[model samples]
Target: MEREKVIEVRDLVKKFGAFTANDHLSFDVYRGEIFGFLGANGAGKTTAIRILCGLSRPTSGRVMVAGIDASRRPEEIKKRIGYMSQRFSLYEDLTVRENIELYGGIYGMRMKELIHRREAMLQRLSFTSYGDTLIRSLPLGLRQKLSFATAVFHDPEIVFLDEPTSGVDPVTRRQFWEMIYETASQGITVFVTTHYMDEAEYCDRITIMNEGKIVALDTPSVLRQQYGTATVEELFVKITRPQRTMV
Candidate 1:
């Protein structure tokens, strides 16, 4: 069977006054795949992400997430998708369980179901002992994992993660990618952005951007071969950085 398109973007653009953050961007994210979005700071990745997640409006273009119109049906789209921002969003004062319950409430989960899920999640995450621990008390890595678990607890069709592994240790970053892979295997589309070129290689396919336009899109292996580079890092430098030419 053919893979399903969970996110569709065509001629997408986002502008702030005279600045165009996303200039005629276009791409599609398929179901059950990890789609990496990469760009330097202020390269329009965040603007486009906000538009796709329904947090911001697009200046012009067709955008859809999980089959709902992103422009006309943002609320509906929100209900069907999960989001984890670069800034961890859980309440710092709330305990591990309380944070889960709070998000569960936001997702409109029933009390009984939430209770059941709470225990299951804690056990699955090996967080049972930290049920009463405040989010501020948890390690950054643990907090990152818990944030992801809460985002997907409501069984969203897709999950948007913006720079999920920034500031994390190498081991923790690997663990986090394992979770992303597991989520994809379960048929959930994963859309993520990061600065680490190594992490970019973890994505099944990636879209590299510069100045609000997609510079390249392909699997890591293909990109490397097409660019005749040894690594995604080299490929990124090749695309986004200026090259010195003989005069």
Candidate 2:
């Protein structure tokens, strides 16, 4: 049986003036899998995600997300993806329920469906008790969970999480990954970028980017075997250190 490709990129490029942020990148993310995007800062992970999410235009090359051509039909693609950025975008002053409602409305979900899904999300996160609490009042971990729940309120086919666990505590990070696993189990493709090496191991497969291009892509175990390293961190160091030596 052939799995459907939820995301497809070919020769994708993103340039800013004299700098190229993404240089002819290409990859495919299968449906219902967690695809990890790994790279050091300025490695173009976010740039590639932005283009795929229809948040930015690629400078050149073919890009398809959720079966829609990004360059020619970004608006259509936007409806199929949920994006959670590094910065939690929920309105701090709004209550938890309010924030969820706001995003549901933006996605044009019916009030009835929004209400039902909101309750289910709260139950899943064990956050029903905090439904009326202001988002600012919740602890950071809970807020992060809420932000993720809000992003997928519309049941998007794929979710883009750009450093969603950055600055979160170890316990909270574990909890967040639990949510991610649950989401993937429900058949939502999770495309996430993270700097944490251990978290990279959690992905079904990972792609390592260097200098705006994909330098490595494979299962975490395969990557470790190929690099003769015990961990993703070591592999990252091995791949990136040579680049540093040149400078």
Candidate 3:
């Protein structure tokens, strides 16, 4: 059986005045796969993700997210997708449980359902003991986990995580990826953007962006083979290097 495509983008373009943030980008994210969006800072990864999340409009091209045209029915698409931004978008003053409740309420989850999910999530993260701790007081790793859990509190079909593991220690980053795997195992499609080349290897497939254009798209192993490099970092350097000639 063939896998279903959860996200479809065709010649997607996004421009801000004279600047093009996403230039004719196109890609597909299959259901139940971890799709990594890799790029350096200012490579347009965030711009592209924003367009797909229906948070911003594209200048041209077509985008269908979760079977709905993003430009035409963004609200419908919003209901089916969860987004965790790079900034750890949680209220610092609020307790972990309160933050979860806030996001659940926004998703329109019933009170009883929210309570059940809240318990499960806290248990899964071993955060039940700190349920009442203010988000600002928690360590960075715990705060990141809480942000991720809050984003998917209502169990959306697709989740977009933008640089979710930035600033985390290596051990914590590994733990975070394990949680991502757990989420994928539950049949949720994960669309993530990160600057960590090693993490790209964990993705089922990855798309690398350079100067607002997609320069490489393939599985990590295939990308390594194609670039004749041992790692994604080496591959990325090769792919992004500009041609030079002796004068």
For model 2, residues 212-231, the per-residue Cα lDDT tens digits are 99999999999999988899
For candidate 3, lDDT tens digit of each residue in 63-111? 9999999889999999999999988779999999999999899989899
How many Å off is the CA of 149 in candidate 2? 1.0
User: How much lDDT does each candidate structure score?
Assistant: 0.92, 0.93, 0.92
Model 2: how far residue 82 lies from native, Å: 0.4
- Candidate 3 stretches with Cα past 4 Å from truth are 242-247
Cα RMSD, each candidate: 1.4, 1.8, 1.8
What TM-score do all the candidates reach, one by one? 0.97, 0.96, 0.97
RMSD of 2: 1.8
What shift in Å separates residue 146 of candidate 2 from its native position after superposition?
Answer: 0.7
